[model samples]
Target: MQVSSLNEVKIYSLSCGKSLPEWLSDRKKRALQKKDVDVRRRIELIQDFEMPTVCTTIKVSKDGQYILATGTYKPRVRCYDTYQLSLKFERCLDSEVVTFEILSDDYSKIVFLHNDRYIEFHSQSGFYYKTRIPKFGRDFSYHYPSCDLYFVGASSEVYRLNLEQGRYLNPLQTDAAENNVCDINSVHGLFATGTIEGRVECWDPRTRNRVGLLDCALNSVTADSEINSLPTISALKFNGALTMAVGTTTGQGKIFTSLEPEHDLNDVCLYPNSGMLLTANETPKMGIYYIPFSKPVLSSSLNQSLPPAFL
Candidate 1:
């Protein structure tokens, strides 16, 4: 979708013509309103969030009222109002967005990490501030209690950017050769990173010390395979509790609960409330699995019947 640059934030308003109401009868007005509602419902059912090019990352706000996503070919961030089932606004960016985080429930504040090591901050009005990291970042997590942004990349050290102080603090050191993704536990404030060596390291942000380590490759290996053959981590997420979900480049995902292997796994997301797991891969459809302690069950693919508009 075409969007204005940071300097050209636009305001959209709706106004009524003086004779518009008188021109339509009450029955016709009701029919038009009903048609509008039906169209909106169809769009919501299809979940038609689109981008001109490939979508890099997507996130839902804390309140579950908005969705923030980034797309390429002239990078842009689009915010959608889920409650209204419409695009709220979109802003063009200079660099491709690697990953992004929503900093507020209302989505007034957002942070975008670019591929060129640049970190940008945007407010509700427009571009707010920006900075750069020393290395190309893969993923980042925000620790709400300390207001610290932890960024991980293809290096052992995790860069800490203090949003409150607006400066870089000492980096968190790791023994792993490279870090691919990071997340913070909302329930207990534990910082976790998924390394390229197929290990998940847990840390305590308060003490800046490594508390635990999980060798995912070892746990996932079959009797015939070796640990060194597993691929690097491609996705990682925390369930706000003890469980952490890890996905590998080869489409293998391991969590407190396990899932059958697929192909070219892209990302994994968990819905604790519904005891469900959603996985996106290199295919046109997504996978939904029922999360069970014993062998998890593959529910279905997201290839459902669509309205004619989608066709």
Candidate 2:
């Protein structure tokens, strides 16, 4: 409950009205409630505000202007203004929104992927267009420089979807496994995918050829199921043109540049305008790594060799 100065960090805590301790004295509870009331008076309070349904996913626009959130039961995306903290817009979806992304360069356009379909919409306006994928895609990444193109990973192929054209360009075949997550290195014009086979594949944008691979450590089996020997990648992200991070179902993680060994990383991301990488796992812990555009010195051990890109 201790926090540093505002110059160092700012923190906010929300209450769901769920009491943790079943035996707090009435006087102690009243004192805590009074403290919260005093703190609320100093803040802009939006009392009794509620969404139509439980929110499933929430995200902020890249520019930090708008907040986008989706509901668990309702097929919709709602936009809120950060300055006013007021709901600005809400668009209906054909199905439950699986995930969404606001284009890094064009914050006005948002691409939403659902369980069976995907749609592109203007953040201020309504729906712009919608399309069906050849196969249901679970995750996607946008091409940076072009800003109008993105790649969707399906079961065994990667499909390039150009929002400008409103159709898929071509499918890049991969090892016969489902692609878990894909990330683009726009500076290098390359994209990487973490596959069900527990390997990371780096691709050539123009030719759609496999240019490199990062294999996960499966040297020892720990479970009774043989599937444990094959790590399924749960997350993949490129820090920049030269650095990548991969997290596997086996709770293992690796940094592509040095092929360093890490563990319990379920997801990884690079800060938009900072020399930092973020990772988290089901352990519910997060780690931050600093990178000055070179191979970072991780505390983890280095063992396996990676494809040409790692070296």
lDDT against the true structure, per candidate, is 0.67, 0.56
Q: Tell me which residue pairs clash in candidate 1.
A: none
| Candidate 2 local lDDT, residue 157 | 80
- lDDT by residue for model 2 (177-286), tens: 67877878757878788877777788887776889877653532344434535667776656555666566666543333421213443334344444344343222122
The top-ranked prediction according to lDDT is: 1
Cα lDDT for residue 170, candidate 2: 73
Q: Pairs clashing in candidate 2?
A: none
How close to the true structure is residue 41 of candidate 2, measured as C-alpha lDDT?
37
Minimum summed lDDT over a 10-residue window in model 1 is located at 302-311
Give the Cα-based TM-score of candidate 1 against the true structure: 0.70
lDDT of 1 by residue, 1-311 (tens): 11112223221111101112347898886676576653223212114345665555666678777767676657888777867867889899999887888888878989999999999999889898889999889999999998999999978999999988878999999988889988898999999998988888999999999999988766666775544466667666665376666666554432222333334544444433444334433443333444332123222211111100000
The candidate maximizing TM-score is 1
lDDT of 2: 0.56
